[model samples]
Target: MLGVLSAMLCCGAVSAQQHEVEMIPFGNMDQWIDRQIKESGIIGGATKNVYAIGPTATVTETKAYKNMGGSPWATSNVMARVAGITKTNTSVFPEKRGDGFCARMDTRMESVKVFGIVDITVLAAGSMFLGEVHEPIKGTKNPQKMLNSGIPFTKKPIAIQFDYKVKMSDREKRIRATGFSRITDVEGKDFPEVNLFLQKRWEDEKGNIYAKRVGTMVVRYYTTTDWHNNATYSIMYGDITGDPAYKAHMMRLQVEERYAVNSKGESVPIKEVAWGTEDDVPTHLLLQFTSSHGGAYIGSPGNSLWIDNVKLVY
Candidate 1:
């Protein structure tokens, strides 16, 4: 299923400075091991698999750690009941690194016989982010909710960088292109996605969402990289709605050519430099990490993503 993360932040302004930002609490994964053992099992609440998608599932999810010193990071205990066996500890962990730690997100593949007849393979991916996870609601088209609960950030950053390593268990490369969608199925190991959204947003009394784009980055890592930015990042403009050619796509990449990523890992579009101007105030930042490419669907098991040292460079 889709692992959505919600980020929320109050409106404010940050001074302009060339500083290394520590936006994510416990970014080093130092206390994650202890948190895992103590806060594991059932921290938030339990979920029932009424859809009968597979394995007659019931998931015990972790509660969102919202009040942990204004930090919004959270973990879910993704366990499933398959054939009456209670499965526990299926997602989110801190793996040991060289005297430090790295957060590892993984996916599990499950084979279940639906209706006691056809066998179906399902993929379940673990995710981590700076937001809240809303459980799925029955009788609705919504699979799950990972709404943007952002923080008031004002400083303009040159780039967001981190260290990452990927490992895949399956050898199936080359995913077929579904259809009209240009997103052709490609081969390789499993795919993991990292995205950040910095925007000037607000909600009225009626909760109507309105926002002005600031900056963003969408990344897919293949090889392990050490502190690199702009290689695959794009910053957004203040408003992209007026563009007649703007066609909405996945992740709301609706801006026409107002923004673009540098192929050589350097400057973004000149128009993007207009982000975070005096007019655009009370911005909110959202960043998320996941080990799967598909939306609300299981992926190949044994796909692992190790992330470390996420920081913002201003």
Candidate 2:
């Protein structure tokens, strides 16, 4: 579902007609499968090694997952993995659109009463990414890496556009550190986000990693700013806005930060370059979307998001 052309041109003067590039197949939610979990084995009268099936989302034309080194995003069902003692769940389903369908994500909460009653809220989101899923390894921390080596992309895109809808709950909530110690505020407002990353990178003979970010585009809404249905948003190149942690990861590339140090031993600030420039050899292209703002931790339950008709206009 990745190609370049122009068909639906709007809102801008164009020298010639440009066809829209479909980066994700099944983006319209015309196809899906039921949620299934398999038991790998059993241990001491308890179910153990439960994992979700692969290829959750499909591309209508091309074999995107098999051909693209197992694309890491799941749309049909939220793939939640246990991190330490916390279990994360993000449930997704297909909702009827005008004629076809769109992906819908919902947030819910679960309570555990083993030692003491503890309520864990899960903010589900529809997401796609570049990585694999595996069980947490013993003696290892954060066994799964979020980003894998991305697919080969050489073209410079003008904008990333998509259709989305969001509905937030009215009840506000918060998470406490101990029983009554308030630490983080979990507000009623939630959001959906989309991102695109283009990079020129490679590895050395000594297994050292190196990369230069060529371009990126990010669109995120943390509040109930735009809650209309089928709202079209075209994120132009260089339109980057997010939290400081998100911005720092975009600037440093996360491969290595020491490489950007100046002569005074201070890290030099790296800026985001223009899109589609033929300055660096293109090595990777990563695109991801998420519906929840607090997937790293617990979030507000009952928040919902819908998305469809994603395109890359060039």
Instruction: Score candidate 2 by lDDT.
Output: 0.44
Number of backbone collisions per candidate: 16, 7
C-alpha TM-scores of all predictions: 0.57, 0.58
TM-score quality measure for candidate 2:
0.58
- Model 2 clash pairs? 5-19, 6-18, 6-19, 6-20, 7-19, 73-129, 156-276
The clash tally of candidate 2 reads 7
- Candidate 1 residues 171-288, lDDT tens each? 4653322212232444555677776767665444543445556665555556533533222233333444343322244235423221221234232221222334435653567666
The residue-by-residue lDDT of candidate 2 on 168-238, one tens digit each, is 65656633222123346665455556666776655545444455666655555555544343333333333
| Model 1: lowest-lDDT 10 consecutive positions | 4-13
